[model samples]
Target: MNNSLQDTLALVGRILLAWLFVPAGFGKIAGFSGAVGYATSVGLPLPEVGVAVGLLIELVGGLMLLVGFMTRPAAVLLAFFTLVASFFFHAYWSLPADQAMMQQLMFNKNIAISGGLLAFAAFGAGRWSLDAKRQRV
Candidate 1:
């Protein structure tokens, strides 16, 4: 593909992926008490600390990915987080019938997000990214 097309694709990918996390981080922030309760219910260690860290990764790391700043590291960290979330909260489990489908959907979504993050890690931030500019310098 030509440079223009590649650049456009990268921009689109970054925007779409970054947009996904913004709401998640905002949700964690907006619903801090609920998040803490949920985390504790899920048996996540240090629920408050975990929620804070998760919020930071989803908000800051996600924004960095959007702008292609520290793209590689951000993507990797987000990918790891996504994978862990999938296993912890979204994995197929013996839950009540009403909630089982929702859990399945969340699991699938996290898996897909992880795939996207891995792709970004492999491809770098593209021509329009800070990583690319740094490379040029």
Candidate 2:
């Protein structure tokens, strides 16, 4: 594809990826106690701290991805974060039969998202991004 097309695709990908994370981060902030409760229920050590870190990563890392600022690092961070979260939040193997299907779907979805993020980390943000602009300066 042409450079313009590639850049536009990258921009769109970043926007789509960020869409899932940014809103989730805000939701975590809005429902902090509930999030902590959920984390605790999941047996996460230091549930509050985990929630805080998740909030930061989802919000800040998501914004960084949307803007394509430090895209590689942000993508890498988000990718790993998503993978870890999938194991905790979407543990299909631990669920009963009916619930297992849904959890499996969610787990697969997160895996796909992580794959996209890893692609961004490996390739970069493209010409429409802040990372690209920074390179030019």
Candidate 3:
């Protein structure tokens, strides 16, 4: 494929992926106490700090991905963050049987999302990105 087409595809992909994270981060901010509570309930130490870091990763990292600025690093950060989240929030094996299926599904989804993020980190944001612009300078 032409570089132009590839770049467009990368831009669109970044936008689509960021769509999931940006709003999620905003929602968490809106419900900060609730998020902290949820994090605590899931057994993470320092729930407040966890929620704060979560907001930064989801909101700031997501915006960086959306704009294709420092895309690979942002993607790498998000990938690690999501993987940790899956373990902490979706510990299906420890849950009761009835809730296990849904938790398992969520766990799998986080893994899939992290996989995509890793792929993006490897492939980069293409020619349309700020990273590309910097490379040309």
Candidate 4:
């Protein structure tokens, strides 16, 4: 593809990726107690802290991705975060058969999301990014 098309795709990709995380971060903030409770239920130690960390990653890291600022590091960080969350929250193997199906689906989805994030990390945010702008300076 041409550079212009490639740049547009990178911008769209960042927006799409940010859509999943930014809203989730806001939702966690809006339902702070519930998020903390969910973390506790999932047996994560320091549940409150975990929730706080998750929201920060989802929000801050997500914004960085949306703006294509430090895109590589942000994508890698988000990918790692997604993988960790999948293991903890979507542990399908530990669930009953009925619950396992949905959890398995979620786990696989997260895995796919992580793969996309990794692609961004490997390639970059393209010419539409702050990273690219900074490079020109």
Candidate 3 clashing pairs, residues 3+ apart or interchain: none
All-Cα superposition RMSD per candidate = 1.4, 0.6, 1.2, 0.7
lDDT of 1 by residue, 24-126 (tens): 8999999999999999888888999999999999999899999998898899999999989777777568678888899999898888888889889898989
Q: lDDT by residue for model 3 over 1-137, one digit each (tens)?
A: 99889989999989988998899899999999999999999999899999999999999999999988999999999999999999999999999999999999999999998998898999999888888899999
User: What are the lDDT scores of the predictions, listed in order?
Assistant: 0.90, 0.97, 0.93, 0.96
Residue range with the least summed lDDT across 10 consecutive positions in model 4: 38-47
Off by over 4 Å in 2: none
**lDDT tens digits by residue: candidate 2, 1-137:** 99999999999999999999999999999999999999999888899999999999999999999999999999999999999999998999998998999999999999999999999999999999999999999
Instruction: Find the 10 residues in a row with the least total lDDT in model 2.
Output: 39-48
In terms of TM-score, the best-performing candidate is: 2
For model 1, give the 10-residue run with minimal summed lDDT. 85-94
Ranking by lDDT: 2, 4, 3, 1
Ranking by TM-score: 2, 4, 3, 1
Which is the better candidate, 2 or 4, if ranked by lDDT? 2
